[model samples]
Target: MKDLLIKNGDLVFTGTDFRLVKGSEQLRQNVESILKTSEGEYVLDEDLGLNRENILGKGFDEELARTDIVEAIGQEQRIEEVSQIDFEKNGRELKINLKMIEMDEEELELEVDLDA
Candidate 1:
């Protein structure tokens, strides 16, 4: 799969010049999107995102939060299985280490961040 490269929510190239993201880079982008998007935010796919309602402010349980995120990733067809997950929380910021297998049997390690 290939997609236009996006950085900071904007296309990385101007008119007539396009940067494409392919292979592992594209997969990484998909993973990032899954983590960054809150459930119900995208009108087309209301059930296709993560539920981050309990990740911010008070009543934050690391285990529950990680479970939610893991389940969200599991819902994606491209991911075959999640082998490992490591979460590091600092205030409203979170760092996640993920090891997963793709549908094609490729194993990948990804790092994702969330800021509440």
Candidate 2:
């Protein structure tokens, strides 16, 4: 029952090859409209709604950015696979496995495997 409201949020596509895309930061700010748009825009569809009883799993990226402290300390952390997010694109369902390393509340830095 946690409600997350992202204001002026930037969405990224975490693909197998670590391919990133500017996902609809240019689209309307109204979150409802954005969610209803096609997956080509990289927005999660209706089935992915926060209250839809279909949110597979969730995690927090507490310290979203790589800071000097983190580098200095070299804290050992692993990118755990949270869940596979599937969305419709061109009449086909595409799956993207989400992996996250919890940071703080600054920004959400999703872990992308460069060596896919």
Candidate 3:
């Protein structure tokens, strides 16, 4: 899959031309987008993204959070399996570490932080 490259919430450009993201990089971007979005926020696909309202709170339940995050990440079609997932919470910030295998056996190690 190929998509317009985005960096820091903006499209990438070089020499007045936009760049494209493909393969693993594209998958990574998708996963990151999924993680950062709140459930029901995407107009076209309300099913996509994590349930931020439930996932973020003073009472942080690791198990439930893990399940929800895994479920959200699974929405990406390129992912074949989810491996290790670890979490660290600091005040209102959430840090997530994940390892997953893609459909073509490509591995992805990602770190996602949520400050919502």
Candidate 4:
């Protein structure tokens, strides 16, 4: 693994309520800080919600949803809707559709469609 070299395509998260920017050192700093306080694996979606996992295959779950209120309730509906957002590395395909959900929440769904 140490001998492996790779390239990471830029990941940009944009939405009506929140944006997890890419190529910003400031954002990287913030992310690093948050990761320090976090346990397990996590992924940032278009709505900037952090998905965390205790084990490897726990799957993505909304840990925090974007909201105007820091201490708000029932406002998870404020995020932009996401119908289908998928990414497959071995299959080399990416598809996204934002019109699936009724709510305005953003969904950054990423998946790997690998073949055995």
Candidate 4 lDDT over residue span 3-116, tens digit each: 111113233344533333332233223332232222233354333422223212323222232221111212233323434333322232222111222232333322222111
Q: How well does candidate 1 score on lDDT at residue 6?
A: 73
The lDDT values for all models are 0.83, 0.26, 0.88, 0.27
- Judging by TM-score, tell me the better candidate of 1 and 3: 3
For TM-score, candidate 1 versus 2, the one ahead is 1
Superposed model 1: Cα runs more than 4 Å off = none
Model 1 C-alpha lDDT per residue in residues 10-81, reported as the tens digit of each score: 788766898899998888788878888888899999987789976776687778887888888976678888
Q: In each prediction, how many residue pairs overlap at the backbone (N, C-alpha, C within less than 3 A)?
A: 0, 6, 0, 8
Runs in model 3 lying further than 4 Å from the true structure: none
Of the candidates shown, which would achieve the greatest lDDT relative to the real structure?
3
Q: What lDDT is obtained when candidate 3 is compared to the true structure?
A: 0.88
TM-score of each: 0.87, 0.17, 0.92, 0.20
Q: What's the true lDDT of residue 112 in model 3?
A: 85
Candidate 1 clash pair list? none
Query: Which tens-of-lDDT digit does each residue in 10-52 have in candidate 3?
Result: 9999989999999888898899999999989999999999987
Please tell me which model should have the higher lDDT, number 1 or number 2: 1
Q: What would the TM-score be for candidate 4 when compared with the true structure?
A: 0.20
lDDT of 3 at 22: 95
Indicate whether candidate 2 or candidate 4 has the larger lDDT: 4
Look at candidate 4 and tell me the lDDT of residue 19: 35
